[model samples]
Every structure is written in C-alpha cells, then in structure tokens.
Target: MKALLILAAIAIAIPSFSQTLESKQINYLVKFKSTRDLQTAMKKSVMSGTKANADQKVEVITEQMVLVSGKNAASAPLLKNQNIEYVQPDYELGLIETFKADGQDQKAQVMDYLMKNPQLMAKAKGDNPLIPQSPNSGAARDPLINKQWGMLDMGATQMWPVAKNNKTIVVAVIDSGVDYTHPDLVPNMWRNPGETGKDAQGRDKATNKIDDDGNGYVDDVVGYDFAGNDSLPYDKSVAAWQLLLGGGNPGHGTHCAGNIAARGNNGLGISGVAPNAQIMALRFISEKGTGVTSAAIKAIRYAVDNGAKVLNNSWGSMGEDASEPTENKALRDAIQYAESKGVLFIVAAGNGFQGKGYDNDTAARPAYPASYPYSNIISVAAIDTKNQLGKFSNYGVKTVHIGAPGVKIYSTVVGGKYSDQPIPFLAVWEGTSMAAPHVAGAAALYWAQYPDKTMAEVKAAILNSAAPISSLKGKVSSGGKLNLVNLMKY
Candidate 1:
C-alpha cells in the first residue's frame, strides 16, 4: 500500500514527503535569517552535558545554512535558537564510482610520446595515418581517447575546431577536490582574477593571510575546501578496494573534472567532452568520500559567487525511495540560489543500488536535490556504449531529465600531471556520476557557443537536441539520450 501511494504520488509529481530527515550522527544543518544572528543562536543551540567534539562549532556555511556539530538525537538544541528557520540532519552524500581503477594500459612511452606530436605523429604512425582508424576503437593520437567511448557517443569532436568560447566559460566540478596539477587538467583551471596578485590593501595575493577579495575565505586561489575548512580542494583521501563499493576515492573529483574539461588536441591523454571549458574545483567531500550536507551547500554558493556559470555535481545523498521525494530546504536554498545566479546544475541521478533501488521511475522514489524540483537542474541517467541504460543507473520518466554515456569512461586521475610534467595515471570509470558530467560538458559547449543565452535556453537546446532512442524511451523524462552533435548544430 505504501509502495502504491509512493508510485501514485510520483505519477502526479506531487511531493508528499513528511518528516524532517536526519542521520543518527551528531551533525545538523541550521538555517538562520542573517549572519549577525548566528552568535546568539550558537549559545542557545549547543547542548549541555554532551560528548560532542570541541572542534565542532557553528560554522556559517552559506547565506542560508550553518553546520552545527556535537549534538546527539537526545536533544534538538538548534531548533531552540531564536530566528532559526529549520534544522535537518546533515545527511551523508556518496560519490558514485561504479568501477574501481585498473590503471592505464599504455602502448609504449616512445611510441606514445611520438604519436602525441603532430609533426612526429604522422611519421610515428609510419604507414598508418592518425584518423578514426576504425569504429570499434576510436583511437587517434592519444591511445586512451579511442577507449573513451563517451566522447564519440556524444559527437564531442565535431565542436573541437570552433569552440574557442569554452575557455571563458567556467564549469565547477563540485565534488572531491580536483588535482589542479594534473597535466591534461592544469592548463584549463580557472584563475581567480580577484585573488591573483595583490589585494586592494597591498597584501601578497596568493598567500595573504587576509580574505583577499573579502569573499569570506582567505586565499582561495583555485577553490575552497569546505569539508576541511581550507583552500586546497584536491581529492586526497582514497579508501581501499573493498571500500570502493562503499564510496570515496582520491581521484574521483579529478576524474569528473577531466570529464568536463581535460585538454583536447594536446596529443596526450583523453580529451574532455568540452575540452576548452574552464574548471573551478570545489572540494566539499572528504578523502573518505563522505561529507555533511551543509558542506555541499557551501560549495554551491562558493561556485556561484566565484563566477562559475555551470556546476557539475557528481554526488548524491544515500537514501531509499519513498512515497514522495525527500526534501532538504537548506540544500534546496543553496541550489536555488545558484540557479538564481545563472548557474546550470548538472546532477547525477542516484546509483540504483544505493539504499533504495531506483532503477525504475526515480520520480516515484526520488533522489534528493535531483528529485528536488528546479528548472535550472538537469538530472541525468546513465547509459552504456551501446546506448542502453547502465545496469547501475537510476531513471525516472518524470524526474531524471536525460541520459548520457557513463560506462567505462576514460579520464584523468591524480597520480600524474600534464604531458610536460607527466606522472600520468589514467583509468576507465563508470557511474551516473560519470554520466552527469557528459551532459554538463554538452551544456558547457552550448553555453560557450551562445554565451549570451539564458540557462533555460541552454537547457532547452540540450534536451531538444537529444536523439530519442528506443532504449531510453520509457526510462527517462526525455525518452532520449544527449546528442552533443545535435546540440552544436542548434
């Protein structure tokens, strides 16, 4: 009967979720009206006679959310604070890594190096020219590019020649920290014009003790790491192999960033979907692949305030499907704030095997934030090389917006830098997390070509251009998969 009710609510897209959800863990998101009100609220909110951590204090995470730690389910002290709007559990968000890293299989350092050089590549190929040699393998110059079927699936190469505008467009990879030093990724990172050299007060810009731009964070040159309350947002902590099934990876963010903007035509490594687009690394998740909901919200505001127009969120909360979609107001406020600021959010539809098996209609058993209603949000399902839905992907005819290639995708990892400073380590990854970025790259491509278009306009262009395939017919809202070639023609 409960299942029937949930399914019925999904069919109508009517939100029926009741109850303020929170984990048993000692953390919660408290929202106050203004920053000035935080001090008094903290005093009233801290529980007495508790064993919470002293380091856990009220950290003002965003304009609408605050991270309050050290409280048990025994008492809801945050709710007692004056001007406190709402407090919900700081839920755990998991990174969707469908496949573990197998490391790169290189052809040979000498041949690989020679093939990357346009001048040497022709001769290096000897008798064979560097063309789309065969359909079975898209191998061109970079050995791994051919293995990245997602690139070919979306027709990403067609825009490489003309999309110069992508460099100016910033797509924030809001997940684990990015490896800014990665060779294929280094050239394309977003430089902070506000925090580059010297502050208005004459402090050394890069290492100044002050918040150079008065943006709250001190010396956020690349991006801020809210999880650690620091500036470096590189993915650092990776759990072991058996732990991979649980969540967390050292190179997850780096992989996702590469999906959005790894360099193209460099003759090294795989090319990004929107190869020229700029990446703004926003690290809120930990090396352990877990983070509080408040941290994720802060990352979104940071991305929007820092001039990132498109945000790729390859993460989602761990929860089961209910009669109605779960709602997180504080998180929703942050997402809506970004959308209001003209940021397009490309989110991964949940992995089907999480707490809830959402392989069917995700709308009926919705995933938070993705299932959360917002026009600026583009919830993506995952598909394989054959254009079939991935076995692990979640879909919703009304909730998940579109499908994109997510299986066995080859992209950059942390162990290496660029070709010049090459300590290269690449891998073939999978997940709806991988799939969302493809749509993000597609959106970036469209946004780059028409820089002046509205987010709604860009969203429409992407959905309109999708190739309606039978495989995706009943599985997704679009009943089609993303078509970058068609998006470019639009």
Candidate 2:
C-alpha cells in the first residue's frame, strides 16, 4: 500500500512539472506620478518584507518601473499591498517559463489587484498621446526657386566622392512609417526573410497575416508596429500631437528618411548623401509625432536586434518634466546596448531657441536622449545658408556636438512623393530636427568609407571635417558646419 501511494505522488508531480514548463513569465509595467511616489512604493514593498522563494526571482527595474517575475500564486498579495496600477501579464513578444499556479485564476487575481489600486492606475496612465491633433500648422509646399538654390549652392558639395560606398551598412529610421512603395525608396527598403509571405505564383509578397513567421507580429512584412500592436497599414493622422507635445508630424520623419538614403541620381527631385546604402524604417513615433519613452526604447532595441548600423532620433522635449529618471535610464540603457552591438546613434539638440544658460532655469528647457551619455550618440544643431546658426536652433557648447544644413533644405515626402519645389524651397520649415539627419547621412558616408573604423573614429571624421563657421564659434563644439568636401579626404 505504501509503494502504491509513492507511485501516485510521482505521477502527479510529472504533470505539474510539464504545466510549469509551458507556463509563461509575466511582465508588469508600473507607473508613478513622480519620483517621490516611485520611491515611496519601493520603500513600501521593501518594508512589507514580501519576499519570493528560491524558485522565483522578482526584479523591479527602476528605469521603466517594470517588475518581471515567473508566474506564481504568491505574486497577488505582494502586488496588492504595493498599489500597482496595471498588471499586464504575458504581453511580451517571446515565450518564457510558466508556473504551477492556476492560469485563469491567477490572471484574475492580478487584474483584481490592479483594480483595487485606483490611485496607482490613475498615476500610471500615460498622458502622452500617440498622435497630436493640433500640430504646428504651416504651408506644405515651399517655393521652387528657394529649394533649388539651397540644394545646389549651400553645402551642395559632395561628401562621398572618393570613398568606397559601403552597401553592406544598414540604417534604421525609427519614426512615422515609411512608404515602402515609393519609387525612390522601394529598391532600398529592408525586408525580413523569416516573415515574408508568398503569393499563388510562389513569389514572396508583403502580406498582413499574424504569426506567419511565428515572431508574434501579424503580417509585419516590412516592420512591426508597436503603437497599434497589429498589422493594420500605418498612416499618419492629423490628431497625433495631443499625446506628445511635438509629436503628430510625419513630415519631419519623411524628410529625414529622404536625406539618409532616397535612391540618389535616379532622376529624382533630390539625391541622398549615400545613394547606395539601405534604409530600414522602424515606426516608433506615430503619424501624429507624439511618443513616450517606453515606445522609443522598444524601437531602439528592435533596430539593434535586426541589422541597423546607424539610428537617428530627431525629436526631443524641453521642460522640468523632461528629466524623469525612469525615462533617462531607459534611454541610457538602449544607447549602451546599441554601442555594444556596434550601432551608431544620432540625436537632435532641439529647436527650442534656447542657449546653454537656459537648461537649468526650469522654464522651457532642452530635450533629453540627446543629453544622455552614450559615446555613440552625436547631438546635432541647425545652420542656415549663410553658414550661421538658425535663430530658433538650440545650442550648447557643452552639449551640442555639431551643426548641419537645415534651412530651406528639401528631401523625400510621404506617399511616393518628392519635393519638386525650389531653394529656400518650402518656406520656413527649419529646425535642428532637419539638421540632425545631415550628420546621420554623413555618418553613413563615413561608415561606407571606413567600414572597419570604430564608432569613435566615425564620430571624429564627422567633427574633424566640419567647415569653420565664424558665426557659430563658441556656440558649437566644432565651431562650424559639416563640410562633406573636407570629409572625403579622410
């Protein structure tokens, strides 16, 4: 009878182990109103002495206030006492280990814990919208003469004349979705081999289907959309700015994309700095120009995981709220990861018209991610045709790294369109946002020439090649605008 009991116990244990093996780890994104609130919660959790067993490990990463742990029955009491806002489980892309707790019942427990903590939930709810409704309204088409002159006379000097163009290098443009069907861009767009679909003729097709490649994204033929979380075709909406202060503008991203790699010398309206390099569009910012730090982090990670050698971020914010610790750490970690993966990151120094003295005033301040420390991140400012800094461009000798042509510049637009307008072309759309891409494109040219150069070398080539601008002396680090003509010599 004793032997029979032992055999029954062993049989029950086997099934439990199988269930646990298939169980998935749960990730919880917790938000607090302020650092004070976040610290309070952490203190409470620690004082409560709610500890996990040897089989479970609870890691609360402060950067994003994320708590990751293996699924278990004990998570409920600890979460309940800590006042968590939302407990979204199994929302991550990949599969992980499971626990022996009741799956359905455990999910309910987690949800209930969140519901009981209304204050935490309210605080966690992000106010930053995915799209902005009333963005900076301006004329779309700039004059043709102005566009033409700016393209030819001002900094029209070619930078990649003698260097061997590196076709193997890939750049990831993380912004509003790219029109892959655009004639100038179709040939240069990146495609995922593992997730491509096929037609009846057995030819590869970009389709909208879920899990076709078992990568968790449905019909992400070109790239995955974190905003929508599904394969509905991404298009810019006018109302995207309400979520993020300066978001909800796809025009900015479209123009930047064209500058980097828009199929040069193909009878197109304008040519890119590196015509042969490939462009990968990663849409982290929605059509309405607004995005949170979390979404940006995910996009950075995605670009690094895939085959992006360079990453461009041309957006930022200015204010007291911009210096949140959680968001800062996330940006730092992401950039560090990119550096480790041998990828280069370029960001804008903001276009808020503020000087270096205005940063700590607590009024409208300079933007972040640009301010973060990562050797690979190059902060850029804007310069006009006269080789003088744009009035509205932000500058800091300690922070702003370099300057590039931004005023009256023309490049690619959405919907397979080209800006045919002339120099000083499209009236007055000038900002550091526009200038950052020039540096990014130049980086591509540098990468193509010295494929073996470390990130530091490529950075030096860009700074060392800048043309001296007397007007910008003492305002910018290199004290000049980028000179493509001089860069090719290296």
Kindly give the number of clashing pairs for every candidate: 6, 35
Candidates in order, TM-scores: namely 0.77, 0.65
The candidate that achieves the highest lDDT relative to the unseen native structure: 1
Residue-level lDDT of model 1, residues 96-185, one tens digit each, is 553232234333443454446434222100111111111122324554677677887777766667766457789999988888766677
* Tens digit per residue, CA lDDT, model 2, 346-407: 88776552222233113244455566667888888787778777776767676777788776
State the local distance difference test value for candidate 1. Answer: 0.68
Q: Candidate 1 at residue 62, lDDT?
A: 65
The alpha-carbon root-mean-square deviation between model 1 and the true structure, to one decimal in Å, is 10.7
State each model's CA lDDT, in order. 0.68, 0.56
| Best model per TM-score | 1
Global fold similarity of model 1 (TM-score) = 0.77
Regions of candidate 2 where Cα sits further than 4 Å from its true position: 1-161, 196-205, 208-219, 231-247, 320-327, 353-364, 420-427
